[model samples]
Target: MKSKDNFEAVLFDCDGVLVDSEPLTLGTLRDMLAEHGWSMPLAECTRLFLGRMVRSQSALIEAHTGQPLTDAWMHAFYARRDAALHAHLQAMPGALAAVQAAHAATSGRIACASGADRGKVELQLHKVSLMPWFEGRIFSGHELPASKPAPDVYLAAAAHLQRAPERCLVIEDTTVGVTAGKAAGATVWALCSQGDADAQHALRECGADAVFGSMLELPGLLTPPR
Candidate 1:
């Protein structure tokens, strides 16, 4: 994971890394919680849950509400989420170009490791026409023993791609994911275009190897710094 090393693979965190769907999800969650008389600012919502799994979010909410959410409630929430995602989803700016460049640079060893469920991951990638790039290489945090901030999923991705963890490169947009990538010994870069200073600092503290504000900067980062 050294800056001078040539990476064998590039692993992406799907939600914020590939698609600009975090805001849509944040808005949807905010509205859903408002119905239950829970008020939270959008910033706090993103800070708490952007790169987390549904199961974790459910547990947190249940802990706060002092009650467990039923399957029916989760089902309904996801149904609404699907609609919102379908309506607002778009690829991250320059994302396709960045992915293509990274794939070519790594000789086609790119995979998506996301905190989202496989279904949602596939749907969002397909909606943005990014499915072809990741076809059989999609991985979900839901399948891991523990989610982001844990290295299991990223490590799994490196193993499946037949690459050593230290030779893998990871692109993430959250401190949670950066922590996981660092844990797995992959070099990580945090994309913080949508975030403020605190977000940048968090990514650094979590072990991001570099930080940039845009996807447009990715191709440059993928290459060894001269």
Candidate 2:
């Protein structure tokens, strides 16, 4: 396992880590999928799409809906998802405090590396008033050649911060994201904010260097930037 001390930067996953927007996004997706004749519970929808890019599931979506996952359909999903987020998205409890702590400990060397589209990530951050902390430091996997589970996004964020991936601390909320951070050679901490014991076990099994149950616990876990 990688040591957590003397990290040069903190790289955060945007969805479940910073913003409490997963349910809103997944609810919209579940509704839209139902409209397309592929009805499923939000839990199932989340199980299928959380921590991964939506479009990457095109094959399964197409097979279930008996329709092509076209660009227009994606745009429609984006529109609906954004509206729902704008209306109800909130920052995860204690996220602001954690971000402030990260900023101070890392000396402002922090970035939001997200698996979602740039537009969607930006919109959610803005809606929840987190845009100021992330702004130009946000790296969207959708803008890269690959997204989560591929390590491209975290690698890009670490590169932009001029830090070695191994010297960065990655905070993620899902196994797919933890996999990506580990693949990028970073020390990853999984946020198990919902107190899900199974999720904590899964995250540890997926190679998270540590697991935390709240953003409130983050500051204590970090050391001064290298």
Candidate with the greatest lDDT versus the true structure: 2
Clashing pairs in model 2, backbone N/Cα/C closer than 3 A: none
Error of 2 at 10 (Å): 0.2
Query: How much is the lDDT of residue 195 in candidate 2?
Result: 89
Q: Indicate the worst ten consecutive residues by lDDT in candidate 1.
A: 1-10
TM-score of each: 0.94, 0.95
Model 2 Cα displacement at 28 (Å)?
0.6
Highest TM-score, which number?
Answer: 2
lDDT, candidate 1, at 189: 86
lDDT string, candidate 2, 167-201, tens digits: 99999999999999999999999999878889899
Residue-wise lDDT of candidate 1 within 94-161, one digit each (tens)?
Answer: 89998998898899999999877888899999999999999989888888898787998899999999
